[model samples]
Structures are given as C-alpha cells and as structure tokens.
Target: MENKFKKITSLWIITVLILFVVAIILGLLMRFNQGGNIKLDPVTFYTDMTIHGLTMIGIWFVAGMAAVNYIMERYVRTSYKANLIAYIMTVVGVLMLWGAGFIGKFHAGWTFLYPLPFKIMWEQWATPLFLYALLVLGVGWTIWTVSLMISLLKKYTLSQVFAWQHFKRDAKPEVETPPFVLISMISLVGVLSCLITAAALDFLLLTEYYSNGGFINDALLMKNLTYFFGHTLANEMLYLGLAVIYELFSEVSGRPKWKTSWYVAYAWNLTLFFVLFAFLHHMYMDFVQPETLQIIGQLASYLASIPSTGVTIFSILVAVYGTKINWNLANLMFFIGTAGWVSGGIGAVIDATISNNFLLHNTLWVPAHFHTYNALGNVLFSLGFFYWFSFQLKDGIIKDKHSMLKILLIVIGGIGFLAAFYFAGADSVARRYANYPEEMASGKFWATFGGTFATIYLLGIILFIGGILKRCFGFVFSRV
Candidate 1:
C-alpha cells in the first residue's frame, strides 16, 4: 500500500508539472498576442484563453489536494483508490475540455458566462462537451474530498476534527487536534461546498441546453453560481496549500510542529464560514443583485481574509523570527509564498471594495491580483511540498545546485510580470482582449513586458520541475 501510494503520488506530480508547463505556455501566448507580437485569430486566442484558465485552475487545485492527501496519511488512512480515481478523471476531463476548445472551438472563456455558451460560434456540440467535462472532474474531486473527510472522522469525532475543544479557555482534550487536521478539515468543507456548486451549475447549464425552449435559467442566478464555484474554489485551493504548509513547514525547517491554539481554531472556523459568502462580491456589478447581498459580499470578503492571514502570518513569524532556523528551499518557498499570498489578497480586497470595484471592474487588475497569489503564492506552497515529498522519497537531499539562482529568477520574473498587469490595470486597460485597442495603446507595451518576464518565470519553474522529476522517477521505478 505504501509503495502504491508513492507511485500514485509520483504520477500525480509528473502529470501536474506537465499540465502546468503547458498552461504557462498558453498564458504566455495570450500575452504575446495581446502585445501584437503574434496575431492569433480571435477564435484561436479565446480558445487558448479558455483552456489556459481552466487548465491552470484544475492542475493547481489537484496539486494542492494531492499534497494534502499525501501529508494527511500521517494522521489518518486515506484511500489510495480514491486518489487514483481523481487522477484518472482529471486527465480524462482535461482531454475532453481541451477537445471541446481546441477541436470544437468552444471559446466562451473559462467563466463560460451564462449567455455566452449559448451563443455558439463554434461546433454545435462543443458547449455540452465542455459541461460534461466539468461534470467528470466534479464527480472525481467530490469523491476524493469525501474520502479524506471520512478518514479524518474515523480518527477524531466531529467536534474534535474541528478543534472545538480548543475554544474553551484553559481546556485540554484527551486527544489534541493537530493544526494540520483542523485546517485540512476546514479547507475540505469549503472544497466540498464549491464542488457541489460546480456540479449544480453544470447541471443547470446542461438542462438549459437540452431543454431548448421548454426551460430557461435565470441569468443572475447562473452568474451567481458561476462565481460561487470559480471564486470559492480558487480561494479554497490556496487554503489547501496552506494546510500542507502548516503540516510540513516546521518539520522542513527543523523546528517543532505548529499546534492549534484557540486563536488558530477560531481563525480557521471564521475562514470556513466567511469564505462561503465571499463569492457574493462578484455579483456586485449586477444591479439586480440584492443590495443586502452586495453589502454582505463586501463585508464577507474582508472578514474571510483577515483571520486566516493574520493568524498564519503571526505563526510563521513566531516560528522563524530571530531564530537560527535552517533555511532551505522548502521553508524558504513557504516564507516567500506567504508574502505573495498576502500581496495578492490585498489586491483582491481593493477590487472587492464597492467603491474600488467601480473603477477596476474587468480591468487587468483582476488578473494581476489572482496571478500574484497563484503564480507566486499557492504555486510556491505546492512547490515546497513537492520538493519536501521528493526529498523524503530519495532519503537523501539532492542538493539544488543553483537554488539561489532559481529563487532569484522566480522572484524577479514573477514581480515584473505582475507589475505590468498592475500598472496596466491602474491605467484602466481592459482584460480578455486579444489585442489592445488604440485607446489602450499602453496595454500593448505592458503585455509585451509581462510576456518577457513570464518567460523568465517559466524558466524558473522548469528548473524546479527538472529536480523533482529526477527524484520522482527514481522513487516510482525503485523497488523498496
């Protein structure tokens, strides 16, 4: 079983890295096209956009889940079969999704916003194929999530899994809930909720398509559900990476494992609750959306971010501040990743604000913030886990020959790339255009600049993947 687990995990790492590299290339293509460096037809550019967005989101999400599941084995027995199932489904679904885009020319963008999919400029069958792909991915992920939750439950009671015992002052329980278990459970709940939302959204979409004229779905509700799934899942995946960090950061740093205190428990619980509602912010532009919900969305966005960010940052600081800690690639990534997450989060908050949203809505700023977190933040978190997991498998440290160089490239490249988006966004450059219009001429320059830096970022990721690939190949092939 252990060997099987390692092999499965090795396969996951390989698949994710391959998909990630492809997604990065697609993104760079879009940026170059926008800069007028390349001239892709409108349909082709949008097709790349759709695939690039969904693929990046899908791969990174599973990357975090795979990392979490591997580490969760330390606390509870996870189902290897479920892990494998998700792997198979992810590959199959991605194929179908790409076929829908690349082959069928379904280019409605990743959001596939309510009316857009229906306005078929592509193959008539492409829309349903895309929806079906989502269904396939959703089912597999739901099964894996439920399996992990059940595993945790088998070892700890409901309240214990949530660390309710820590809520009471000076109270100690017979079995202490590790910070990892608590955060994992919290994150898993959010993951399950969003997957269900995705399932429901897909169902409605499919229903409307088949219904033809018999039934029509409300645009507002569909849009609401779309962001509910997309925004929530995106945020939850980051939390999933954070869960891995909480578990492995200290261990990799040669420090004591983090413990769940009352504040830690409180903060995560608050996160779980508020995150569910944070998606409402996306509906702020819809005047038809209830004013009350809009207000709640603004508040929830702020509330959802504060507790987790505050507590986690404090914990990390306490762990390393002024201490002669062992600083290696893994922990260093965690440290830098936290900074990235915070930076992106601040950008998100700025845009989530009602007053600011009026100015930044649909601007490149939207991508700027999310890319900051995903590219620099959550990506680093998973990379840290990947390196650590590979290290364990080898039972010997494979020295990163140019570790400093890798970090320097990633940091410089990531910042430069994001800065272009930020600057263009602040200048009110609209996103999702294949080419910048004359009025937004500055956007062309920024896109070219961003693409150049993103190539540098891709080089850094390649180096990281090369090191992991060597170790993973050995682990999968070796007979223990």
Candidate 2:
C-alpha cells in the first residue's frame, strides 16, 4: 500500500519536471523570435506562449505543490485518500484549461484582465469556460488545503501548527514538531488568498456595467488580484523551501536541530508582508495606478527584502560555519538551493528600486531573477526532499550514492543553464515579444546558449528519472 502511494507521488514529481523542461524550451523559442523580422502567425505564437505561461504557473507551481502536499502527508502519516482525490481533480482541471489555452480559446494572459479577454476572444464561450476552470481549480485547492490543515492540526500540537493554537482539542494524538511549522499555516493563508482573489477578479471581469456608463472599470483591480496571488505564491514557496532546508541540515554532522534565533523566525514572518506589498511594484507601469501607491509599493518591496535576506543568510552561515559539511546529495541540494535564493534575492532587491526597474522590468532580467530563486531554491529543495524520502521509504531503494550524484548533476545543470538568461536580460533584452529591436538582435546568441544548456540539463533530469523508475519498478513490480 505504501509502495503504491510512493509510486504515484514519484510519478507526479517526474511528470512535473518533464513539463517544466518543456515549458522552458517553449519559452526560449518564443523569446528567441523577439528580435527577428520573421513574421510568425500571431495565432500560433499567442497560443503557444499562453500555454507555456499557464503550464509554468498552473501545472508546475500548483501541481508541484500538490505533489509536495502528498509527500508531506506521507511523511507525517496522514490521509492519502483526500490528497489523491485533490490531485486527480487538479490534473483534470489543468488539462482542460491547458487545452483551452492551446487552442487560443482564452489567451488574455493568466490574469485574464477585465474586458481584455472579451476584447480578444469574440467567442462568448471563452469567458465562461475560463471562469469555470478557475472555479474548479479553486474548489480543489480549498478542499486540499482544508484537508492538509486538518491533518497537520490533528498530528501536531496547536502551538506548532498555528504558532498559537486556540482550538479546543477533541481527539487525535499530538505529535511534537520542529520550529518551522508556521510555514504550513502561511501556505494555507496564501492559497486561500490566491483563490479568493482569482474569484473576485473573475466576477468583476465578467460583470457588465450596463447600468453605468458601460465602461468596464476593472483596471486597477486585476492589478491587486494578480499581485496578491503572484507574490503570495512565491512567498509560500520560499518559506516552505526554507523550512525543508532547515530540516535537512538539522541532523547533518551534529548540526543544531531546527533551532534558530527568534530573530530568524521573526524575520521570515515579517518578510511575508514585505513580499506581499512588493507585488504592487509591478503596478508601477500601470498608468491608472495612483503615484503614492506605487511609491509605497516600491518602499514595501525594498523593505520586504530585509527579512528573507537576513534569515536566509543567517541560517546558511550558521549551518556552514564550524560544522563538517556533508557533501552528500541532500546537503549539496541545500547549498545549491541557498545559492539560487541568494542570487535571485539580489536580483529582486535590484528590481525593487524605481530607477532600476525601468531597465529590467519586462526584460529577461525579471525571469532570470525569479528563475534563479524558484528553480534553484524552491524546486531543488523539493527535489532534495524526494531524494531523502525515497531512500528512507524502502531498503536499498535509492541503490547508492551514484544515483544521488546523477540527480544533483541534472538539477544543478538545469539551473546553471538558465543563468545565461541573466546576461541577456542585462543586455536590455525584452521578454514576451517575438521580434527584437535592431540594437538587441545580437541577444539571440545568449538565448541560444541558454537553450542548448537547458537541453543538456534535461539529459540530467532523464538520468534522475531513470533511477526512480529503476527503484520503483524493482520495489513495486519486479519484486527485487
């Protein structure tokens, strides 16, 4: 039974990785055409880009989160039934939305800005279909989140689950927990906010103001909606990844066990607010937005950096200092994840600045900054968890250290491959455009390099997948 659950979880992880690699390749193809005069069909380009973005956020981020939820449940000895149901629902909904996006049914960008989709898609069916998909996604997310929170509350002490448990306990055993339990609570809040925002934004976009001046005035509303969901999701990822890294290193060579300074915990908590407010920084280019709000947004954006930067640096420095570093795959993952966050953190700080953002906002720099942190930081940290857990699930399941090395090589190689994007962005390369200006024509070289590197990175991923399949097949069917 356990083997069956593990197989499902592992398959999902591999599926997400495969999708991520595909998305990156497609994104690169789209970006490479930015400066070229070759007139590609608008329908094809728009549809592909739309699908790419949706897959990245919807499939990779949300689906990967589902995978994480399942893993956490398995680890904590929680219910698999609910998690599996949610996963199936999410997968079905993802396919529907992705299919629609690919057919150019609804390509008003993921935000689906009010009156925007209506403008582009003359088909009346498009809006309802898009909203319905979002609604389904929201329902699945709500159920999964509620189930997860209930499980965590049942398994762990209230204080650990919510920082201060006020609920009257009726039944279930209380499991002692480490310090970072607040991450789960934060994730729940983030997910809730994401769904609520999406729903509200959809309603506003769909409603007609015929009684008024017939002007669909949802301009700045989508700004806030998208910002909340976008920033909150990223923050959730960072917090969870940080927690995982802490746990991984706690037992490494006599290192301290998940105990850090109060300042560190407080810093991460406060950083969430900073990250939330920083989303407004994206609204700076919106002409309809108030000037003071933009300034406040930028300030919040900068202020948001203090907590994450302080906590992560302090955590890593302490972990690395005076301790024998375990050069194993798990520890290497910790270092690599730390590296990505640090690199992206620096890039993000630069973005918070008003003067600098003008140059970097829509360029390859934006993704470079985020990809460094998310890909290296969150995604890799999750991978480390899989590697650690996979070995513990069954005896000799992971085979040997060689399997671990292959996994790391592939993960790191992929992230390193994306670094070329940073250089291209720094060269004033704009993103999401199929053609480039004369000055930026040479930028294709950097992009091509990144693409080639990404392919090699995929090879590494193939190796990692092979190891998993070998173990799972041996344990599940081959009866080794």
TM-score of each: 0.99, 0.84
Q: Cα lDDT for residue 117, model 2?
A: 65
lDDT of each: 0.93, 0.64
lDDT of 2: 0.64
Lowest-sum lDDT 10-residue window in model 2: 164-173
For model 2, residues 402-447, the per-residue Cα lDDT tens digits are 7555755666566655677788888888765555567786566766
Clashing pairs in 1: none
Candidate 2 has which clashing residue pairs, if any?
33-434, 34-434, 34-435, 34-436, 35-435, 35-436
